[model samples]
Target: MPGDAARPHQASLPPAPRNGLVPSLERRRLQAYLLFVAMDGFILLASFSAIAAAYLGPGGDFAGVRQGAEPAFLLLPLFLTIALYNGTYSRAGLTDWRQAGAKAIAALAISAALLNFFAFFAKMNAEFSRVVFTAGIVLTGAVIVAMRRFLARRLTARWGRGAVNRLVIQAGGPKFSLPDSIHIDAREHGLRPDRADPASLNRLSQYLRNMDQIVVSSSRENRAAWAEVLKGTGLHGEVIDEATRAIGAVGVVKHDDIGMSSLLVSNGHLGLRARAMKRVFDLTISLAALIALSPVMMLTAAAIKLQDGGPIFFRQRRMGRGNGFFAIYKFRSMREDDSDGARSASRDDERITPVGRFIRRTSIDELPQLINVVKGDMSLVGPRPHALGSRAGEKLFWQVDRKYWQRHGLRPGITGLAQVRGFRGATDTEGDLSSRLDADLEYLNGWSLMRDVRILLRTVTVLVHERAF
Candidate 1:
């Protein structure tokens, strides 16, 4: 090959087996399990206490009779089972505060419902106060979420970075591999670079001098050559199987491999029933929103007309599913000019009128998009629709990557997961775009009516914060 010599010699030094020296994977897993058990216990305790306070309060004899202990014992196990079945324990590290809080709330709700159902069937419903049950669930959920946040902060601060695997690579090819793929895979495994080098072995040596472990990703044929090159460097050497490397690095089993298939057979498409329900919900909600916000929309139109001599409604052709184009509607938040039509509005952009800024920040400008939702061109929750020609530098929104349009598989949303997560507004970098897509895909895979409601709630909170324009 013309570029064989130019191919930088790379080495993979697999991490040393910490065996008895450091915390083992089993230990970590056990610790995580225990943490969840403790959390469930605490939640159950809080729930019991709250219920007692609300129902068998100072006036009630059952408050001090230890009668609630039996119920707590019964509910704690059920709560744990529900939380486990919901993938709460397994996904603890991957969960954000919003996700954790939502799951805790959901698990508590399910447990409460089951408990109440049993009570009702046994004709013991009168034994407990409905207010007590409701208050208990609410208070327990709040306390659990607060505790989780505290624990999460501590965990992230103490171990998030340290728990990640460290890898150093020496490129030994004419063309260096894409950093994006490496970063993506690394992020999945919580493995990240302390530092990266694309050039000389000396740089890699200098970088890894202080690090205890490193992994090199390069061709199998170059493994021996790399090992021989660093024979006396006092660093261990190992070869990374490129096929398995990507899979293992990302902790995803390759579909073609039987090992992975056996472990994850339950991986199924989002259910058809769920999709149908979502569509129905979207239609009903969008229609209601359009009807309710019509007056506000009319007022916004008048405001736009009075402030800027531009069109009241801004409609632009945005890329929808299957590369189809649809005119997305929004209140006119920018000037009627070529610049506004051609480019994304940036912070302090001259095209944005003062009223436009306020509307954009408050997301009142997006209220008109409910019409688009009602028209079936969009949904109340999904990926935010971008103009067909919108791009970052030379990369058009759709042209950036394949996953960019994967989000378009569902209807574009007026207030998407991305917007609620503060990834809204101008996406000037690939990182911003990638994060937005990630949030969108997360929503797609985990869409539920409850999730929609939560997103709406968070959207209000984000609007109030006004951190992102």
Candidate 2:
């Protein structure tokens, strides 16, 4: 089983209907988003260049604005960051030309004000031509608005209001349907919400990979199970139930057209704007940390090789976002022959080499996971991922508490509230795991960028702990 290539539930989903329109549409929308960003950036640069050239006479050296052009680079990133949060390039913005235009203009205005404020405070306002820069901002706004209108018209002509892919599953509870949605009979597809079976979960994931929204119509007994399945998929999920309001549903979505209402159970932990911000933050921090710590990582790798001539990095499968599995990387610290990841290392373990012991003490062994963060398998701050065979005392992790599965609603992090609160080291007792799980769930309930920054800063204090071995 150690090297088994096949998963327990390895059957692929039935071939998609409509010639794979679901996946193709998903790809097109993503490409459109990227295209919008690229065009906006180009418009900004071109508008600024033209304005700068026209502002100065022909006899004037065009090379003089080189210093002035530096501001454009700074402004571009700032504007794009603001636009991301303002929904200028979001899915909704892409389909609605008027909304997109409004958001783009607002983001441009805010970015310009912020840039001017920073330039004034830093005593760099005189570094660029204010007249040309101001004119360029106005020109960029006009061009962006027109471009969005044209693109949105084209998209609407093809996909109409339902630009997203929606899936409706009938599972023997009630008859529910939506316009322009792909309807599937779960029985026909061999789909059932068997939470205990990885194969069942994988089959469900395949159907949900590109879906924007899903509505499941199932019997009362199966609604809860189906809800759990949907939560792990990280999509907008709902279940048909008229009594949902009385049972404390998160919210309700009423469909006036079909005269039916569903209980909105799960929408992941973050919205589109929040997810975009977190992703940008993760990439920026991970890339910078990788660059700054390259020398230390190199030395550690050399020492690892010089000690036992084993692999410098250890790779193991860990449960990631959506309860999926991804290979996690770590600096090898245990003896090569004794490197069984299914077993947890104990304090004062003889299997650890001298360099390994030192690196583990200083937490340098976790540096390799920065690569995981960059690969989108992990975040900079959230719940920490555990090995598949991890245990809390004599029982496996999930067996100890049913609520354990709920923690995967968000992406796992390199360092989280548990690690910052000194909850690191081995999990020898159930209480140790419970305390960390409590922290993890609390983090999921409430997440903010500021909280992540504070937790990261606090992690510095617990880098070296007695429990670490």
Candidate 3:
């Protein structure tokens, strides 16, 4: 609700041709995820049995074999974790067998390395069977990946024939060229995802009772307004664009809709592996920082209470990852009676008490944001959170650039490239926000753990500024 407009009224979409190959993969994605886990478990068990038989021989101790296979269960979690870690599982039905197997194999190699690393730490490497580790895991990974591919082909083909959800794309005008094959393919599968007119969206519910998806071409007018309107309809909305860079950053699958290669402009961000790694990083740092800095925080809390008996923490509704609104916390650096919580603080503001100025200057006021990182509302290093009334001059933040909101692709952070570049305070010029936007987009496109670490380390030296500090 902070600088954003109220949700638009629900509009009925125009009548659309409902023909798709299976419902949109969005609805059935979870079912396929579970299936892969099961298939992997089966394949791993079978491969282990074969390897065990050869290693133990036909007459070797039968009871020992059963107990021996018990340790192999550890490999199941490892397999699943590695599969998830590398995105072999999360990106289900989006890739072909070759790509899937390649990713799976890479995951297998990493899992093997992890197994050895843990084994070495536990001093179990000597007792662990090397032959089974190499041969059995290799065999298991091959069979599972191949089986995974076969199942993907089979399920997609099988489900493609059944009745599925309908997707209707509305282009601004009729001049856009769309392929008839798109309608034909959907018709063949009993789904009706065809091109429609954006003007008649007010009648969407009347024409298509079971419409599951509403897609908008990038060329559509007032995209934000239309998106908000459709949001009230309770159907998932996607903006399909031909721009590869914009699409690739947000889209998970490159869908050839009609005759055009369209990108699904949502579900973009750090993939499964990166998110998992970042979460681990967030927890490690947040918990450690909280423990190490408890005394400092306690003193700050007391100082604020004694200063004017005001609340120590200031919580504001700020935008987060996925364009979601969350309460961002900070040690209050303004007077408790300041009614304009949404406004940016001017240099030498009267609302800032003496203690507030020092904390803000030293960058200690933002330290409480570590709680946001641990709570998963933010990351340790990212685009800084902006208040609802956050603006560049008279215009609100999102209004400055069409792609500005894309900065929400990652969670907001306490400090970022923009801050280190000295663009942290009030933005009076358009160029100032653009400079910050450039840094944000740059961080997103080339994000890495090392880059995150470097940014975090770099943040310490630049936390204090002459003017703002």
Best by TM-score: 2
* Per-residue lDDT of candidate 3, residues 1-469 (tens digit): 1102222333422234333233344445556667777877787777776777678888868665654454467677886788876777654433356666877788777777887888899998776667766777888888977786787677656444222344444434222333221222212222221112212322333333333444545343334443433333334455554444423323433445444444344433565457668889988988999999899889998998899998999987776654546788888888853332446677768889888998888888988999998888888988887766666877777677756656766778777888887777668778888999999888877889988898888888877876573
Can you tell me which runs of candidate 3 are displaced by over 4 Å?
1-58, 61-90, 93-214, 217-219, 222-267, 336-342
Give TM-scores for every candidate, taking all chains together and pairing residue i with residue i: 0.43, 0.71, 0.63
Q: Arrange candidates by TM-score, highest first: which order?
A: 2, 3, 1
Model 2 regions more than 4 Å off: 1-21, 24-90, 96-153, 185-192, 198-203, 245-248, 336-342
- Cα lDDT computed for each candidate against the true fold: 0.57, 0.80, 0.63
Question: Candidate 2 lDDT, tens digit per residue, 163-255?
Answer: 777789898778866876889877667677766554455456666666778898887767877776676666778888975543345788997
Worst-scoring 10-residue span by lDDT in model 3: 186-195
Q: Quantify how close model 2 is to the true structure by its C-alpha RMSD in Å.
A: 7.3
- Per-residue C-alpha lDDT of model 1 across residues 97-182, encoded as one tens digit per residue: 55666787788788878987887899877766556556666777888788767766665554442332233353342222322111
Selected candidate, larger lDDT, 2 vs 3: 2
The positional error of residue 285 in candidate 2, measured at the CA in angstroms, is 2.2
